[model samples]
Target: MPLNLSQYLHLRSVPSFRTILAVSVLLRVGLILYSEWHDAHSVVKYTDIDYRVFSDAARFVLHPTEGNVAQGPLGKRLGLGDPYTRATYRYTPLLALLLTPNEWLHPSFGKYLFAACDILAGVLMHTLLTSAILPHADAHSASPARDTDKHYARPSTPPSASPAASPTRREQLAMLLAATHLLNPLVFTISTRGSSESVLALFVLLTLHAAVRARWAAAAALLGLATHWKIYPFVYGVACLGVIGGERGVAQGWRGLVGQLVNWRTVWFAVVSAGTFVLLGAGMYAIWGYPFLYESYLYHVHRLDHRHNFSPYFYAIYLAYPTHYVPSSEPSVWQRVLASPLASFGPQMALALGAGVLFGRRRRDLVFAWFVQTFVFVIFNKVCTSQYFLWYTLFLPLLIPQLSMTPRRALQLAGVWVGTQALWLSEAYKLEFLGQPVFFGLWVRGLIYLAGHAWVLAGIMESYEP
Candidate 1:
């Protein structure tokens, strides 16, 4: 039965939810207005350069070829070219199709769309965590738990244990996390710049929300849609399977893990995911042809951008680069080495799988395991970017209630992370803008940034309660 608005308003958590929603909405609205004013006054506008790239893609999608009166639509094609030709746009054609209206509509339309998705993601995150913790709210005692990382004591309340003069504990945690994502300046800045990663994030959040509710098929389809759009979401597929198996109380230990993987559902998940991705790609292929294929899928597989890269290996790759480079039919041995999972991606996969197996023992474990998996993924990615941080941060806040770190300790670690980034950015700035030859210096900074993140992640791991 559908509940009425009044009934919803009277629910225990509604007021807090409303507060979160209202504050977030107001903040976004204010940012939009501020963006307009800033664009009017400042050279560096709020909207990012990607907005222009998206607009160009929309233009191409709207008119795939520059139409001629005499030649019809088959003259020189204006569709998205290969990455080498249309270097500005290197993503799926579906994004261009989705944003086709932006060609005619205002540019802010895209920003509004991405921002809406970003806010929606926060709502889903809250919903997933709130639902997850509610059932077990009454199952635990309210005794304070000892923080193991340091010798500090923290109140470990039963999930939403009712208390005098306060809201339910779970609701507060959920609202806090929701607010964290909604008001985060990093996410806000990206969404304002009209990045589509938030759209991808919304679908991934939906996938998790569906899986937590024991809806396996929906989870697989949603995740598949997300993976087709971007490759990183595939890492969370194991968490979805774990949710299904752990919820149903399968066999114990490694046997349960194996049983989880060897089931009909797992097979169906694979089939559906592949079917969805292939169907989407096939549809786009039928329209855009191989340029779409190469730019969207193949390019990322062999991507080796040695410039403006954040990985520590950038210097090594730069030094190893051929003095006089030429495109070839076959991948060079060095290219193969970089592309190989054993060399670059093996550690990330292994860590993600280990985190899934160890921490993904139940539905409650999904969010934390997801955070860890993504943490490892970004840290180990060959082309880590600021946008990639959004992936892990999507789930990181969900673990705050479960984490036993003190405010001061968390801030200390955050400062360490920021200092490392500042160190790298200083060198990178000189090279990129000032045109200084600081490639080796930037490489040293990248290594420092990598180590700093690893240290911060270790601190986070130690602070996690489960």
Candidate 2:
């Protein structure tokens, strides 16, 4: 018999589900209000404040002809002619364009704009994960064992052993993903702040979704915008290219890979992406003048060498010999070579390329490869700030349904999330203890925080098989 619509509605309207949804909405609204209030309280009354540095940079790009930077003309009026020196401000011209409308509003208003973007990004993430995981669950007829197998398999497939399956298990998986997205502190914080991380994350999710659907042009365009906002997203193209190539191979698994990449759509995406980047760059140069653009935009890419050495290995080595070692001032040839050693690069690239080489042979493995490639780049980079966690946050939720997660593992992840929030809030509020050493409390909290993250990352790697 067909299920009654009224009955289904009654079941879904159960107190638990409705209560959870209500709580999620309340938490989101509360975080947004808190962030807005915090920024307002921190305001310097008649004077402009220096927080939200990225937003300020965006405003500068939007009004380059006015000889302004991201912080606005208020800086000039206050005789603080150069805000760039006080903050690291660099953003793509496209992002600047997005912030143009907000530039006219008060900085507090800009905070709201950022918070809105965060909420939208979270919604999109939920939708993408739902779409991505539902098919596998349905194929298993809602069998938990089959669902578990599919989660860990390379090329997830329907159980030929049982053709007549149900949708109960699929519904369960969707609920879990929704719960994770709603409760994850990292996601909550990013969404509520006036930061570009959430927007970049939205673009990342869009790019991945487009790629899966074989919408090459749309994917490429989304990727172009993502890269323009932050350069990290561009590296994902390497993984995508690998997938395309792998789809064409046969005996060597080359046939399906070659066919996917040589298509007209892929070609169009490439062309559009190149053109978009060039046009955007040219526009910035024209408005800001080459000198200002070079110093502000180009300089960051060139100056990455001298930044803090944030890799685990670097931190370990530095701590072992604190007084003897000094951080490099710029990217010297040796520093670049050491930072991205050939040995590490070769293996990482091989894994990405190899995943492409074996594309349809294992669908689950391909996603894992892409995740590992991105993770390695971020974790081993020359600078590892707390904010850098945003990159991992962007993709980790998508992998939850695909991994062999246990209740224990889930609890550990929960613990790590809570620890991260405590550390982040402490840092954000500049909380101090007893004022013995001004930075003492922060340093102790930071060490504990990094250790917690390291534990979670290790757990993830151990759980991964492909």
Give the lowest summed-lDDT range of ten residues in model 2: 1-10
TM-scores vs. true structure, each candidate: 0.83, 0.66
Q: State the local distance difference test value for candidate 1.
A: 0.70
lDDT of 2 by residue, 1-466 (tens): 1111111223343334345456666776676667666656876332123235656655554444334433333333332222233245555444445655566765455445555555555565556655654455334333434224443433333454322123443344444555565567766665555555666766777777787776767777787777666666666665565555444443343565566555664466667766665666565555444543655456654343322223333433333332434555444554445444442445545554443444323333435555665655655554566677667655665665455555566677768957765764555364333333224444455456556766776667655543
Please list the C-alpha lDDT of all candidates, in the order they appear: 0.70, 0.53
RMSD for all candidates, in order, please: 6.4, 7.9
CA lDDT, candidate 2, residue 383: 52
lDDT, candidate 1, 349-380, per-residue tens: 78887777667666666777888888888877
lDDT of 2: 0.53
